[model samples]
Target: MKKPSRDFWKDSAFALASVALAFAYGSLTWKRDLPNLFRIRAGRPLAEQAQEPNPSLKFTGARGRPLRPFLFTGRTFDVFYFDHVNQPTAEFARATLQATSFTYATLPFANFNQADFRGSYFERASLRGADLRASHFAFTNIIQSDLTGADLRDADLTSARILLTKLEGALFNENTKLPFSEAEAIARGMKRAK
Candidate 1:
């Protein structure tokens, strides 16, 4: 049998090395970018992924409907229905949210400073640790909502109802207006502070 040429041996070794290099590069790229790829597919930027809640977990509404997207900023909401939707759940300092129904919506730690919420409804909504200072809640229905650890200084709650709402540990000042009397407000857990 004829011996293989030296050039053939060299060509085979070079091909083997190329294949190994290609495999290593492909694997490293995939491993490093897999999470980012999934985040992009879900239509969320990578920087915001860590800040938002886990997308795999879902929220079900009172009527068994899938939760809708009620999380936004600096935008107007007309007759909007805010249920248990959760995502980007904060930092709406200058928004104009006018929801018709905010029943059972969980908006904890949101920044609503200088925002306007006229003619909105927030029945049974959870707004713990929110910042509503210098904001407006005129003619809003905030019945049975949880406002624990919330800041309401300089806020206008005129004509806003807070029947059965939780305001324990919440901060309010003389500038914060409530439809109820001062005694009634304190009786319902709303506090006066500086």
Candidate 2:
């Protein structure tokens, strides 16, 4: 039998890593990937883009608690950041914020309802079920934030980027401020807009 060569594992790992990098890069370069990449890059830490997200640094939630605004009183986080917080559950809900730069935070379930997230950058944050009702997002940079189930009732998404995403469960009433055509369609439960 032939003996296994030295550095075999290293070479295999390198190849695998290379493949993963290529795939990720390819996905990012695609038109559909631009918004997400921009969102993630924008929210990256000033020191290191690859730094592991530390929710503890700017937040005061238990290990098991989700990333909710009510739970994260006076906490800090944003769009262009890496949010390894709540990785196990991948949740951030009901969080109150103001003038924070979250360009690319990876908050899949970030609940932003009833929270004050004015001037926050959610360009690429995954805002699924992030109840944004009665919140003020004026001039908030939400270029590519995922609004799949996010409730926009009474929320101000005016002048938001509103990139390609799902608006299935998002609510927008007269009290809400929208981007005219798109917002109107979304408010009426229209699909295929995002």
Candidate 3:
């Protein structure tokens, strides 16, 4: 009121300085973690992302041609049939098979044990009697495929689409990770291996 006291000025200066320092410290501390928090939202570099192989390109045959379904069976095993007569033979055992378009491809009696076929598209493809034990087929599409008598023991089918696929007699075990429950698979005519 009367005259500004020296102590008043000193208190004002200290308050201003304290606010400035707090702001500076906040900015400095936030800068370190800002990039990590916003990198994904701000579109991170492609190199930093988990890249998947081009499916159509990876499952190609000689000269970059798309491969056909392959089939083989021993005398002890039952006969398996694939409808693709014009496509070339292809096997996918212990391999990472990625195919964007495998419609009408036949792979009856083929061995796919311990293979990774995640996100593969297998529409109308025949996988009858195929040995797919211990395979990873998460997010795969097997619509309209013939999987009759196929072995799916210990296979991972999380979020996989098997609509209209022939799963009759297909073998799944307790170790198999199906997208649906065991009751649903059994209702759909899928059998559990004894």
Candidate 4:
């Protein structure tokens, strides 16, 4: 058998060292550097890409299912339908979630304090035990949605269309503004918060 040349061993060592260095670098900067790679388009540098208005990123969920992309603006979600999505205990305090749909979505124990939900739809959505303190629900539809044990202190629901919504044990303070009178709200199973 013929013996291998000295240059062959040198080349093999160089290739192995290069791969190891690349892997180490990638592991250290994956979070910051890897996202920039995705932003680049058509051989253009990342700097050339226009800065997005919102820092929040858009992502797709549920592979192999007919689901739309979930776009976020800070803590806000504009004009998106989150039907059948299960996101319990989610935090969205002081968010501006305008014109969104939460049909059949499970959002129990979610924190939506002071959120603006104007013109949103909440059909059959589970918002049990949610913190909706000071939230705005103007012109929104709350059909068949569950608000059991939710906090509605200082919340505004003027002109909100509520139909068959469950408000058993939900808390509402004196500062809470509703579409109906306090007596009517109490008749609908909403409790006054201490």
Candidate 5:
């Protein structure tokens, strides 16, 4: 057989590779999850990725509260106190977390549907893919929380302190109340709010 040019093979290989990676994100599993995204985008410089490597937060203290699938809808939690959680499960979902300090706790994919989060300190907490619809975040401190893919549709985020946090793929509808600058900053991490 006659020899085909090397460039032809190279072009064919490149085309195949592009097609494979085109829908790559569809099946790709991002470790940043919902909450870690916050840390990735805002916590460190966007140019540097390998050094940070999805920073993991260590647990300081955790009060042995009952572990069950907690749910909160149409309720008010004020002046409540809870210790630092090493790692909280879905049990604490939607529970009135008023004045609660959940520093560095990984609650990825937890359900916080319609929960009241007034004065809650979720600094450096991971909440990727967590259901936060209709939740209250008035005066909450979500600084450095990983909110990569958390659903914030109709969720309140007025006056929340978020310095270095990832907000990629997070759902924030019109009803969501966040500082205009912060929203713009967060939109950069996700797929253009689409």
Candidate 6:
């Protein structure tokens, strides 16, 4: 058997060390850097993109479970529960996730812009600073949810059951459709967007 050269061993060690260093750097900065890495382009219609499956678009759910990529439209997520997990900064722009359950999920600053969430459950979910522009929430249950600073411009919330939900600093414009009166919406601390 032929012996390996000394230079080959040195190169192999260098490659392994480089891989380890990259992994450590990613782990240290993932929370701060991951959101910037996956930015959704604005003003692009969902129909403009091809319906091909994107394997690179993966999300982590509770207990490190892999979630379905948010690129697929009209996906029914029955009983999709996330128990008290902190999934801040999740991006679900232009996706359809109907009838999903988000009880006790902490998803502050999540991007749900133009997403169809009709008939979804958001009981006890923290959606502070979430970008929910032009999203659908018809007949959805939002009991005890925190929607402080959420952008609700042009979003439809017709018949949405919103009991004890926090709406402080939430922005809504004239295009936003709501089941209740505008006065009541304002009384709930939801501000009118200029």
Query: Using TM-score as the measure, which candidate wins?
Result: 4
Candidate achieving higher lDDT, 1 or 6: 6
- Compose the digit string of candidate 4's lDDT tens values, residues 1-194: 98889999999999999999999999997755554456311322222221335433322122223322222223666664555656667677888878877777777888898899999999999999999999999999999999999999999988899899999999998899888899998998899988
lDDT, residue 177, candidate 4: 87
Tell me each candidate's RMSD, in Å, in order.
13.5, 13.0, 14.6, 12.8, 18.3, 12.9
Best prediction by lDDT: 4
Candidate 2 per-residue lDDT over residues 1-194, each given as its tens digit: 98778789889999999999999898776643453545322322323422437532332122323433223433445532333333322323445465565544555455555666666665555666665667777666666556776667777767665665566666666677776676556564543312
Show where candidate 6 strays beyond 4 Å: 1-60, 63-79
Alpha-carbon local distance difference test for all models? 0.69, 0.54, 0.63, 0.74, 0.61, 0.73
Residue 70 of model 1: what lDDT? 38
Candidate 1 stretches greater than 4 Å from native: 1-71, 87-89
Rank by lDDT, highest first: 4, 6, 1, 3, 5, 2
* Candidate 4 to truth, TM: 0.64
Positional deviation of 44 in candidate 1, in angstroms? 14
Q: What are the runs in model 5 whose C-alpha is more than 4 Å off? A: 1-77, 80-94, 181-186, 191-194
State TM-scores per candidate. 0.60, 0.49, 0.56, 0.64, 0.55, 0.62
RMSD of 5: 18.3
lDDT of model 4, residue 147: 96
Candidate 6, residue 46: how far the Cα is off, in Å: 24
